[model samples]
Target chain A: MTAMQEGAHVPSVEESDEPKMRDVFSDVPTDTGLATDPAGVVIAELGDADPRILTLSADVGVTLAEFRSRHPERYIEMGIAETNSISVAAGLAASGFVPYVFSMSAFGVLKTAEQLRTGAAYNRLPVRLVGRLTGLAMGFFGTSHHAVEDVAVARAITGLSVVAPADAQSVISLMRATVDREGPVYIRIAEDAQPVYAEPPTYRPGELLRVREGADVTLVGHGMGVGLALRAAARLAEEGVQAEVLDAAWLKPFDAEGVVASARSTGAILTIEDHDVVGGLASMVAEAVGRAGVAAALGSIALPDERLEVGVPAQLYERYGLTVPNVAAQAKALLGR
Target chain B: MRVDTAPPATTPAPSDGDDGGPTLDRGRSITPVELARRADWIRLQTIELIDRAGLGHYSSTFSSAEVFATLYYRTLRLRPSDPAWPDRDRFLLGKGHAATGLWPVLADLGFFPTEWLDTFGTAGTALNDHPDMLRAPGIDFSSGSLGQNLSVGTGIALAGRLQERDYRTFVLTGDGELQEGQVWEAVMAASHYRLGNLVAVVDANGFSGSGPTSDAMGIEPLAARFESFGWAVREIDGHDPEALLSAFDTLPDPSAEQPVCVIARTRKGKGVRMMEEAPQAWHLGHLGPDLRRQVVEEISGRMP
Candidate 1:
């Protein structure tokens, strides 16, 4: 926990009962009672499980420093050519082995999108693309590093599954489900978010999960948005407003059934994500709810359609409506509080 | 309009013509005359398939007919019976506009039924404008966009080392396709990995979809460029299977730890008289019955 040691020196923002409350977003995340690793190191489970699995890196494999040392035989250091790396990953997949192509979200998903669409998804090769520093995770790396359009771009490709995980446990769970799954997949991983699950949980894309239960309103979340929703749910409870928080669970093969049911159960819903509202989970859920005609008042908190700024993670999350209080306020407004 | 009505001044594989045309230099399973005849046949089928489809890459296919003839018939090590043989050498046509020329070659070798060619370019047909390994049996990788094949070839070469398979990978690329930056990335990777098992054959047909390769975006000193990138380079007349085979012989040994690139300099259109003459018009054009008959007669007359 890098945050705890230096956190005392910097005057805290809204000091909490919890020890070492640093809003600077350092190595240690605010714990969410979930048994999650801070390093986002669960992908090594994929390396350990399948002998045919290989790790393809476009100069960003350094992110998987632990996996490389553990599975030295299965690592391929690719050049900075993102498009070429995708094609090469597809070639490896075509040769009867699964290759997890890794790069920063901006580089992996946005830059190499065409090659992935043509080479992997169109061809239905089982090439897993693990995009790191998704959303605004790379705040200090500038707007180019932020992958705001990753989910939207990945969803358009046929036979490509887009999975955005909230934390390390969700990553492991998603990997467990997709390890033997056929076809191409893009995993937009959150580097380090607060631990939410009590233990590591496995998931199926069709099976939606409810993090916290309430009947007054539904706070729908995708990826790290779920962590904010959970925190918002706790805050709203103190205000005598019960909010039900839900994780999108799956992005591409979305849980329309669960989404419609949640909207119906609570006449008010607010969808939130660290991506653009235009094509991200918020848009998908809104469309589904509208088509189902659930009669629920739907609102969304998402990134503006523009380049984001570089700063500490907390400051960027604050500028965007991607924090607990922001979620709580949006939920209250959606419910006419 | 007619660039060159006489025979192409250069051939990929040079020949010592005694009096008439190319004579067999190697007493082999596929003689030079036989190779020339097969190339001619492939060209005829290329026009026939494209004519049936009402539109296709005529010049692109005609330019590399000998390339298909040489690799499948002479240079490549393939088990026609076992199309999915893991140990088989892989061939990918990066300039996949030339795929119509390859369909007949794969069918000739029994990779699929010849009747499959009939449904080509149809609504539900497997054969589209580019090659798909899923639908077609012998195509090693699916390719449509240029600049990707080199990377795929490099991965396949590296996969051979990982999977412990002793299979060599060959890629056929358009000269103009080199303008793509990804091709250079693959070139750099091939050299970095020292993938001696990989061989890239450039179909220097001198014309992209728009016009002459030089006019579109000149990527000249092609051989010198590859040499600078640490690839073992060789330049040859692309229309000659004899030359392609000879160049194939000089490829770096698999254990030599140096990748080889053979630049097969070729005409935009080698077999058909009209396509060879017209630089820009026939890159993509329908072959009318009258023109088809005339081109067929010319190719038939030139059958060596």
Candidate 2:
């Protein structure tokens, strides 16, 4: 943890002779398949489309700078108070304005679960909670900045729609599609997600997007997991083993039917996610499979339920078996091939 | 059986001052005497409702009866027949356990059928231990968890400001609830946003569920705290209708830059002799038929 702060004075990667903790993932792809800074640009467009749309930032005003400049009155800077932001958003929703609360996933979901549950979900308000830089994307900022438990916590909240968008296009499409959604929506976005969609595809909250079709095994993922699943499918294709990929973006009103269908068709399901293994996409898939009585080999590539190691996201992903090779091998092992 | 120990609230002063501040609920015909009597009526009705419910925060409701009455009967701008009037002022109960105090007022105002109060806390009743805005028409926001309503109220005020409406938002919070860290978050945000349409009335009854708020957690110099946070501060007798009316009269204009906080000093279980004497014990308790009859008679005697 101190390693990041120790080299804070090293201004640029080019200037520093030695690779820093942040430079560990220098080769990681930055393209979101869509040419846009989703956080800075999409929300502003949404505000422009609707007069009642208000965007609130909790110490992350930079993400909403465009919206603030365009619709100055609709943008609110709520400092570092995530709990207050949720309740305030609920109030704004109650008063007929759709408020989008933007914050780090670490604070947005985990720190304000009660407020989100009692204030927004209980009241059934249209408060859109946007959690940016979810999972280990915060990297060297350490575990406090990571949000591995966000999905588990958010999915348990009754009326909240827990959504994990794989890339910038998904975030934009989902935001536009669900702006008029009746109740609260939790939008989880990873800062470093690879491009998975060629364009803004049709998005429904509880429906799964079949990114790639195969037969040997089913590779299910959400958020950063989708990219890993895609990469794993490509690697498996090289080995003459075809793996199907499903993007489980909506976790709350989970795609149970799709999970059951995939389980029955493929007979092998491997869930890969950038979250703790206990109560995330894997747990939801497991429940769906068990309830359907499907005879399938189930496996998961996820963060272990323990204190996570502090490093760049790529390093942690590799250490935790969340890479393409590990996922591909896991799928192959599940298929007995 | 006139068993009186504590003195009754002081007689309300004559209402004659006019500093030209914005008057809340102007043109209303209800007098201060009628409003003060309404507070007692709320207390009696709350006791009956709580007794029906089998479990409730008696003293918590008692302490805020006058605050509720003062707001509903004299302060708030409301359309009883039209609870969803977009222009009507909004009130949120941060200390939601004391919701019984405000339930009768909303019912009498015709926000919902009075019969709903009869089945309170039952299986199908919309009236529960806390106020639910979805179930009950008059509630501005649902609040059982303390310390969150202030932020909600701030949001409502922000909405009003954004929509270019003059509706004010009042949040009734418990002093004990101020101990929760979220309250300060709202306190800071409300002032930072310059929500002049927001007013947080602290029911400073000095008793929480455990014991004295000071012993439980010292939140003294509350006025100074709000002042430091850039809020326009006012301290007044919560039980006195005149003082309450004056406080609301002198509140910062809805267009002003600073939010307002009225620290209304009060006693838990006010108007009930036994409850007031030992507020901690009466924070929550059951009364038998005889004791209930006696308490009812004693409270009703103070009406006229």
Best by TM-score: 2
Most accurate candidate by lDDT: 2
Chain A alone, TM-score per model: 0.88, 0.91
- In order, candidate lDDTs are 0.78, 0.83
Q: Model 2, which residues run further than 4 Å from truth?
A: A1-36, B1-27
Tens digits of lDDT, candidate 2, A144-205: 98889999999999999988988777777888888998889999977667778877768666
Native interface contacts retained, candidate 2: 0.96
True contacts kept of each: 0.60, 0.96
Q: Docking category for candidate 2? A: high
Reference-based TM-score of each model: 0.90, 0.92
RMSD of candidate 2 to the truth, in angstroms, is 6.0
| Clash list (residue pairs), candidate 2 | none
- Enumerate clash totals for all models, in the order shown: 5, 0
